[model samples]
Target chain A: MEKGSRRSFLVFSINWATALIGGVLSLAAGIPLIGFAISPAFKKGESKWVDLGLADRLKNSRFKKVDYTFTAKDGWVKATKKRSVYVTDAGNGQWSVFSRTCSHLGCLVRWDDQKESFLCPCHGAVFDQNGIVVAGPPPRPLQKLQTKVEAGILYVKDF
Target chain B: MGFLNERLPLTEFSAHLRKPLPKHINLLFSLGSLAMFLLLLQAATGAFLALYYSPSPEHAHNAVTYISEEVPFGSFVRGLHHWGASAMVVIVFVHLLRVVIYSSYKAPRELTWIVGVLLLLVVLGFGFTGYLLPWDEKAYWATVVGVEIASTAPILGVFVAKVLRGGSEIGAVTLARFYAVHTIWLPWLAFGLVGVHLFFVRYYGSSGTPQNTPEEMKTGKPFYPDQVFEDVVGMLILFIVLAAVALFIPVPLEDVADPTNANYDPRPEWYFLFLFQLLKYFQGPLEIVGTFVIPTVGIVLLLFLPFLDKSERAVLWKRPVALTVTTVCVAGIVGLTLLGASSPKLETADATIVQEVPQPTEDIQKTATLDTETAEVEKEEEVFDFQLTEEEIEGTEEEEEVFDFQLTEEELQ
Candidate 1:
């Protein structure tokens, strides 16, 4: 390279090196910091399967409202909360346990015996006997909780 | 590499970087860049804060407390993000004012001006949404009032309020919704708007000072070292000031939200204080005028400013109407904000500061003499009561004297 070209090349190299080194160092520090920060969002809440009385007690071809209480541990504080769920017998020994929380918003839905349907007091969203949306503004069906039966007892995961 | 360079217009990019900026571009011109820097800082700190933040109403307050008291350097990071938001709002507004004063929004930059307004709106949105994340009393009430104001928009009032709050009232759903908007939606919108603004800036080039002469362009310097150096210096000073505030006076978190507290007085952030003050003049029927009409008219006028002020002259003195309007509007906002801050809300229970009535001259002189006499007695007692050895004496001298002086001062007062 000519003398002028060489001088220009040296200046360009210094600038490039400074930017490259700074970018690399920042990436090295920032990536893990961000990862560590957002890791909790991906982590599930510290809740476990809570047993909600007997599965056999749920009447066949009908909805039985059950209320379960569970203690939730959030950070350093432990809170005992009571929640209601609607359990239905789908015949053939099958069952559907639905969380009372409406799909549109988390407001509790009540099963109206007169209407034979679930009604949300918040936005008037209605769901049918099978946890499916019948009418109103609900985008989808009611949320179903993960359920398991052990020795005639029904267990559902609570978060 | 050569093919890639050719395809990417590398030569043009270098030319843009090496383009000479007007020599008169000073620190005020760097406000836009400083705002951009503060935005980045806020994004980083907000992401970190979001890591430990729980959006549910039950855990939100606890989670914020955990971040402040448990996580490593959490309070410092939260403080930086909080302070960075206020800084961004001020800087962006100043940047807008600078553009208006210099007539930089005129021709070839009208779209840039519009995009800047959109960006300001997004920044305010970020502030409104992020204020609720801490789930405190002030944040909750301020949001309730904000949603109420939105609900006063004539036909769509009820619908607008419901959409904003995610329900009939602010609750868990509102927290989750605001969190998603604050962390995800608003940031992406701001990023796109900033990109368009920066592109327009690069394309049209920097708007020089109002006093720039044609001959001055030839004597300007490239942006790389000259302008970049000033930006670096300005950013450094800003960072130092921000860090000092974060370290010395960290952001405060009030008590957890209590929706049943009827006596709580809610106030909007300082930037919106002008509008908050305006709402005071109107009663029931005229509230729509205060909440919607005036703000909408102000925004429409700001959006069309570049078109309305179409003068070719960039000098401030030559444009009397534009200058006068801008000055009056800015001064009105400042005066209103000051008034709003100093005045107490209607429902505020203990807003008054009771002043201590002064005594007569004879009584004041008697108190002063008594205070001096007590101080002299304490001093004598300290000198005579020192019976310890020199080594023990030296160790407690500072502590004893300071404690005695404070004790005597309090008793005298």
Candidate 2:
């Protein structure tokens, strides 16, 4: 048979067409399967403002770590989660609220009164009073939360 | 027997069993068979453990505790699995080292070497996901850190982290997701890869020892008696070691996962300690260098080893670059692991969030006055609008409801 015979062309066309159809058909199921598996990644955490009691309670120089419980919906379960944040009231209506979450590996950070900085115990990471990285392996500063004072009570946005 | 042999490939299988082994084949060559034995043993033990294991945050720890304390021979089985993981890692690495020492990954066996490297990774994946099944403090925190590490990758980092975590946080869903992947996805992958790897190994035959000449390599004995005996003995020794450790030094189940417990100091498994220690070196903005860039370069180099050292030199010392690089990498890994192991464990045990000491009466009064003045002024100035509007709050809920996948009250009814 000639290399580019009409019958050979038909056979070539059929083979490629079958491959394309087969590929599209597999993708039809494969895409949904993949989407189903990765769907949880896009599930957002709960976003709400949690009240951290009276603003008067917050100290100026030292951070007052406030631990609160709030309901968070994740995947198929709704569970109450306990989380903390350090709040410093800087006198003239200036308030700083830093999420206790460590930037290096998400371990909780503790405020060390002696060092005047936050210390992450997991990797010995140290952050200054302003939540800036000072020592150890912290990649970023402590996460800061949005805080608002409406009626002497301090409210920090939680996610 | 004749009918079955004719229908199946029983005759061919016997022929393979009787295949010749190169004269230079020694105890090191049997490690591959030992690795395979361990993989199967782990699967058997893990299946038994999974019978009683519950993959949920609420039940995971309790299930493990029950297995340890209540179930008959459960702790022993679980211990085999626990230590077997470490053993598998060790055996796989040693087998790989043997291969490298002989430079057995040379041309014609390149694909075999590639698949072997992938199998090594699969074994590691088994270790990573399997450890988390216990859902103890160590496993939970390590996974949190691991997923966080994944999130450090540029661009797709967050997405990868989210996929691994299965949501905003690791929870029941995360446990279930990990369980499914550990038990199902990884096993099937390893099985398929192992089959392919063995096919390549059989097809190419043993690359023989690096020291063997072409004529010496050709001189051989049937695999049945000599090589089979050696392989069997190696597997038996491995089982004895696994059993001895499992029986004598039983694995402990730590406290159940407490995400809120800041007092717990999280540590990675010994195999991962090297990476953990390396991460400490690259602090702050350079973390990406440690977590992603260097490890990635190392893995890429490893995957392309056959191509990189394409000299067809099976002998180790002849390949100076490969020898030096492998030696340095081994030494580095060992040094980092030792450093990490000896590093203080209780550095953060007392590092709980500082309780806001009720300021002295004088300070409290001063703070009260300062707070009232700010509150009075702040009430007039715009409140930072931190609270989401009611509509926005419901809108988020509505969006979440779309992905809920759970039946609503009406639907349930």
Q: TM-score for each prediction?
A: 0.61, 0.86
What tens-digit string does per-residue lDDT give for candidate 2 at B1-413? 98898799998888887888677877788889889989899889988898999998878999999998899998899889999999999999999998998989988899999999999889988877877889998888889888898899999999998898888788877889899999999999998999999999888888888767777665788777778788888888888988999889979778988776757778889999998889889888898998899988988888899898877665677778888998899999999999999878544333434432221233333443456644443332222212343555677798997798988799999
The predictions' CA RMSDs to the true structure, in order, are 23.1, 9.8
Error of 1 at B252 (Å): 1.8
True-structure lDDT of candidate 2: 0.80
Candidate with top TM-score is 2
Q: List the residue pairs that clash in candidate 2.
A: none
Interface RMSD of each: 25.4, 7.5
Candidate 1 docking band:
incorrect
Write down the DockQ of candidate 1: 0.01
Give Cα distance to truth, residue A104, candidate 1, Å: 29
Q: Model 2 has how many clashing residue pairs?
A: 0
After superposition, candidate 2 runs with Cα above 4 Å error: A5-7, A54-61, A92-94, A150-152, B346-413
For model 1, the superposed segments whose C-alpha errors exceed 4 Å read: A1-159, B1-11, B214-219, B345-413
